[model samples]
Target chain A: MRALPLIPLLLGGWLALPAHAADPADARIATLFNRLAQAEREQDFQGTFVYERNGIFSTHRIWHRVQDGKVIERLLQLDGLPQEVLRVDGKTQCVSGTLVAGVGNTPDSSGRLLDPLKLMSWYDIKTVGETRVAGREVDIVSLKPRDQHRYAFELHLDKDTGLPLKSLLINDKGQLLERFQFTGLNTQAVPTEQELKPSDNCKAVAQVPPQAAEALASWRSDWVPPGFELVKSYVRKDPQTKATVSSLMYDDGLARFSVFLESLDGESVTDTRAQLGPTVAVSRHLTTPKGDMMVTVVGEIPIGTAERIALSMRAQDVQTKQ
Target chain B: MSREALQESLSAVMDNEADELELRRVLSAVDDSETRATWSRYQVARAAMHKELLLPQLDIAAAVSAALADEAAPVKASRGPWRSLGRLAVAASVTVAVLAGVRLYNQDEISGVQLAAQQSAQQGVAVPQVQGPAVLAGYSESSEQATGPMANGVLQGQAGWDNQRLPGYLRQHAQEAALKGTESALPYARAASLENR
Candidate 1:
């Protein structure tokens, strides 16, 4: 009887050899990514970390202590501008300096969204090794893209809480483009009130009253790497360009990017493209019924991928345009 | 091309003040032996950084110039006294070369001055070829400034801040990403870094 059961087990393992083992890892990452997304909505905890880019390293002090389950985290720019951001819960509560404005708010906290689970299908997640961060031993999770369209990520998860310790944005070449890591962290102790105080430069920014979530403007890519999905899309008029820039943010579970389509209003927009670190930007000149238009795709994706995305932008009813 | 302009671009790049244009210009013409020598010397002095080790003997630009000189010698000898005019010819050629290089420097290899500053643009540069002669939308004609002073490393007054709109867009992009970003603090830190600056 035992032998008979073992035969099926062996056959099943053989039949499902690849994904059988990988399914669990994929499931783990999906869960972790979900948790990480949810963690932003989290209302509590205080931690300190360091951020480095192009080797210009800096340390940061962050106090995110919560009360009555309302999150109040104050992040003081440990160096330089003395900038600060105090957010209550997940919403930006107050800011110092300028609120890099012109993000045409859709007015809905629930509607301004990106779905993470939809992205997981296109990315391969695997546990790489064990490491220490902020005095805590953590598991290294690598979220590698299945396609060349987007960059891969290596994330260090806090072993105790499954929080992110370090996140690295890596290109298809496996080169690290940007790194965000917590050099030190603490969660056991609630941060003191004084730690959350903003310096003089930390001016208060009024909460952008949430507006009604705009209707989900339907858009589909003319071409996208298989398994990628529309994670978010909206239109924001650039104050400078004065053109209605329709944006669509896409994701393959792990990899994400945004596409902005703008009506040129017949303005001459020289098709331009750029790459900064891991983030690749592609702009394409597109013609529509209205007139000449330019489509730009931005985020941590490959140049070719971004170009393809820029080309793929289309009006839903172009055929119906009469 | 005039040694000074080239040197200025090179030094600016070394200081990280050079934008995409300077960087591309330097990289494209880095083949000159004397240029390569100067580049290597800068590398040695730590004032400039060449992405790789430069072998003085392996300098291709200098080698080509040397090869051309060698070929020119026989031609000059064949012409003899006619080429004695060659000494005068060379002096004229050097002066012409300087003028041509300066002209190359000042005159756009491709003109119209409308070329987009080498930017982190998603799409590549637009073709200078305007088949329709159509003035593109958003082209503020009459402005000698193609992309504002920022493209040329000059700030146009508070107008400099007037267009630093990018800094805002960059921040908004970061903050929006952070608010809706997935598991990584990369977006959050990016927003934070922008705030730092």
Candidate 2:
């Protein structure tokens, strides 16, 4: 009689397994995500978009053209300050004054497109339904964070072009943190060179080569949230303070954060925390055997995650000699 | 305990109506896999009824616990005094947005970056940034006057390395994110927002 009772329980457990099993719909969603990533670089489009966060809103115009695999893109802020950025062949050619200053003159390599497999590890990507954006039908996809370390994203991609028509960043409370939506879009033909050219007022930018590029071996975090990994590390000389600030960047595929450490040079400075839209900045003083330094964690992450990162910064004394 | 009783206690806890005894019961049972599963289901069902986008698998408890474990102990001694001061500084600097009817007149002197950066952000939402007590004392004069109207007024007269360096740091972070982030024009907008001032 006891064996008979256990039979149904065993059958129930077996039935529950398939709910966690890989479904065909999931594969289809992943394919859609990959297409979205690939479409950005491969497609040539011009569009007007508005980015809104908190209470500030701004409109921008983008002219992205690809010729013989060399991508040329120009972005201009339509509303305020006439800020413009022009990039040729994946490197920044110039930017409007007040946009970027004191940067070194080095060629920037093209950043890789978002990898669907990597993002899958951090977010539960799923197609929620369909919607309309910019007068075109779009498929709504939600990339919910697996943990609290990152925010969730809802992307509405054009069904015909796979270009993102609208994207939203939502906090754990489901409150909209930021919104990027295309007010208008054109997906056909490459933009003319004249349209891609920046205004004469656009100042040339200097790309400084990162100092700690070779051995980011100089600092390490004692603890990072699970699935997060160091993506890049470098040292930059402060133009105003003349301090060499070492920075380490980490990402959990879907979300990214950076830690900047700078020596105080005996100048008194208080720790500070500030949030601008989805970005949070936390500065904390750290005392190491070598000396006193200040660590700032800045990223589009939860305040708690930033705090933990600020606390986990450790000097890599073993590699100090280098 | 019966499943029905446990479920009732879970609901009560979620609704913030649980008594002391029920609270203890829920906390004690929180570690059990089945109880946790049940709790998650309740939360999802409730969220669905409310039409909220609730993630069924967001394990915030685990993330927070992990953060707690990683918190450094060395900063403990100096954190106490500065934390209180930090709150005061935050309060003094916060700009209360009078939502519907308040008109922002003549913000011409404010840079685009400054206006864009803090207008919606300075609502006293937070986590205290812990610095050395001595450092806080140095800026005590300016921080005391950090109240809404006086905030920028104080900063204008202040001649400190922070005033010179912080903008650079903010701009650097934003620009770097723009260059490195492959997402879209959002980073570009952010970098541009930093220049309005």
Candidate 3:
């Protein structure tokens, strides 16, 4: 009789497995981004868009196309300097001036992809509204951080395709810090062969192993304001000085910060603090038992958090004592 | 401070109803770390009790105090030929924007570069070559200072090294914001604006 009674419970769970109520849409969104990342690596498209921060703005041109599942993208800095980037599957193939030198090959402080699973723990996600961006209707998803440790985000996903049409970064004060939007988008027609090729100015680059670039481990955040996670971390040599710079990045799904630690070349340096709009940077001088070190923390966090993080950084090697 | 008294003070502080004595007590213990922790704890408890997003860790008092101190220190120096200069009254790109605003803005924050580079960034940023330097520089300063009347923020003269590095630190700050997770445009705009200037 007990076995018979438990049969419905097991059946109910078996039936419920496919449609998890907590984040069915979130999984779809993740799948959509993975597809977009793949498409960006392989597809062909070209468009003009304006990039604006604060009040200053500039126009940019990007041509991306894929062949036999292989992707190639060329982004040109239209204004100011004649900078450009030609990449095959998100990894750079060539450059004009500087392309953040060693990007995919180097350990950089830049955070990684948005994992909705981890993010759901920090941010409450919901499909709140709808709008149009880049001439396509988009569903609005707001990722409001569960804690004040990070800022909030509003994303507009293409309704038809599930791709991100627009994204907005906002602080606790409800002020917009940045916006990334596709003013015009098209997946209906693939880009032509000629459009996918880089200009003569696009200098050829040699591919290097990203792992060979740095052999560093993760830099853990000392006191993350809860719900934050270790998103990405890397070490890259300065393109100019050729010195190694260790970098670690953390994210609360919405807000983020980067810590860069570079060895001083016997040069005297002072501490600094700066804020540009919503972002804050805090540098503190620390004298380890080994030698002197400077910790530079840049993020959109409380100034005190930045300071504390800077102070708490311990040299990863056992040879150096905190 | 008594838990009840502290909670009352916190409530007063939240409602902007604290008397001078209560405000002084809070300010005096602001650096204790534990006291500030307590304040935030109280705030979180109250916010949870009321179901609000209360970020007690944000040291608004320190930021406000520092900003006020920075704005006032320049004036307290009183009189000099540079002091009487009215260029600060208007928003001249170089002396008014980068110099005046950078000192205070950077005093609140930091960079990942070498110590010398960090110091240089804090003290000696240059704009002669950027082409659109003045236009973009002015725009960034104005956007950040939109909330109130900008006084010496971009004016009120500081020394040479200080003037130069502030813009660099400011730019570094913007670039750092641009590299994180998601595809937000605000950080892109900030990085673009810094380059524009």
Candidate 4:
């Protein structure tokens, strides 16, 4: 009798194998993400959104336009300060606020594209459920990290246009770190020239020539979380402090962080770690042969991962000797 | 199995004054729906009395039990009596190292909390008063200058190495991420949020 039952069980297991192997849900989620990427580039819409995190709440209006295969976007804070930013094809053109010294001077480089297929290796992308946002029917997609190195994302995409209507960043403990939700959206009307025009208060970003490459090649990280790749690296000198800071940006397709290396030059600086809403900053003091160096890691990643990355930064020559 | 006895045992468990027998009695009754409801009610009442934020859905006890069940047992290496003293010495050194590490970590945490307290206190004093709608914009702008060092919402204004460099580091990171990121306006919003007073 046991043998007789075993035969059907084996046959049933064989029949279920193919269905489990080819999961349609994964394929559908991948398609939705691909559509989301395309929608960002092709869709032109005007919307107002509220960005909220711990101790800070602000509302903003965005005007995104696609003209001749270029993406031009403008954002203005609806609340205090009336802060405005204008971008032409993802490169910031100007801003109303004071720019950080020694920033926005990098040579123009292509923007990082969202690749759902590549991101799947690090995050488990799945459609959790459906919801309505900004008076539009939407699908709720959750991107959960496979490892504890990064935070998870919950995205609500419009069913018709696939544009993200709401995005929430959640930490490992399931607490929401930050939220971006649209209060109103108009997809039918293309943003006009008058709406796209930045106000006179917006100052043009000054461009400086790229610095020499040798400074960037001097430092390297001994270990980073698996799947994170070095996406960009640059060195800039602070005009005020005159400190030469070299920054290396890393991303695992979905989440990103940057490692900034600056020499302390015998200055007494304590190592510090801080969390600003969804972003975490970790600094470690390193005593090198030449002098002391401070390695600071900042990004939308977990605090432990940032600290580990900060600790793992090593000079290029030290690795060669090993 | 009397209801009154079970209630007493539940209260004992809640107060953490339960003996082995009382704990066992409460654990046995926990499977019943009525007992579970009573337990949760007691939890809410206790939290209210203590003025604690009660997360009703979080059953830390059950989670801890599950974690303990799934934890692997430690494997022991074969040893002789001669090596026992050496093993003891190694263990002692490991304990010393761990204690030293914890002391260092605690110091770092205490300093971090003190810095945050100082920063918030300064921000409280620096917050500009709201006069009118017309001056609101100008007031916020002036407040930004008054709180420029701590305006980024992370650093303390203490004349130190971090106050001078961290804001620039933070802004550079944000701007670079905004320029390179293709996830639409999210990055731009983040960079912009940093600028908000």
Measured against the true two-chain complex, the DockQ scores of the candidates, in the order shown, are 0.07, 0.07, 0.07, 0.16
Per-residue accuracy of model 4 over B87-195 as CA lDDT, tens digit each: 7865764554444334334434333233323323323332311111111111111345455734434431124687667767777788777767667678877878777
How much does candidate 3 score in TM-score? 0.56
Candidate 1: where are CA atoms >4 Å away?
A1-44, A104-107, A110-119, A197-220, A226-228, B1-169, B181-184, B195-197
**Going through the candidates in order, what is chain B's TM-score?**
0.24, 0.36, 0.30, 0.33
- Give the per-residue lDDT digits (tens) of candidate 3, residues B5-124: 765676688668999988876666667766777777767877888988655667787798778888846555556656556455334435533652454344433222222132233333
Which candidate leads the pack in DockQ?
Answer: 4
Residue A60 lDDT (model 2): 89
lDDT of each: 0.56, 0.67, 0.55, 0.74
| Residue pairs in collision within model 2 | A104-A206, A104-A207, A104-A208, A105-A207, A106-A207, B111-B197, B112-B196, B113-B196, B113-B197
Residues A1-322, model 2: lDDT tens digits: 3236545544543453354236777677767767776676678999899887655678889998878877788999898679898876657777886543434334443555666666666677789999899888999989987666778899898898788888888866556777889999888756897999889978776766655554276677876765678766677666645788787777776567778888876767655544556676666778876588888887878766786778778878834654
Writing each residue's lDDT as its tens digit, candidate 4 over A1-322 gives 3236545544544465445336788778767877887888899999999997666789999999999999988999999889898888777788887776656645755556667666666677789999899999999999987666788999999999999999999876566778899999999999999999999988998775555365556887777876799877778778898888888889888778999999988788777655667887778898766578999999998777787789889888776777
RMSD of 4: 16.6
> What local lDDT score does residue A133 receive in model 3, on the 0 to 100 scale?
86
Model 3 per-residue lDDT tens digits across residues A204-308: 654434542243442344455555565555566766557666666666655767776666656465565544444566656666544666567777665556766
Please tell me the interface RMSD, in Å, for model 4: 6.6
If ranked by TM-score, best first, what sequence of candidates would result? 4, 2, 1, 3
* The best candidate in terms of lDDT: 4
Could you tell me how far off, in angstroms, the CA of residue B89 lies in candidate 3 after the best superposition?
20
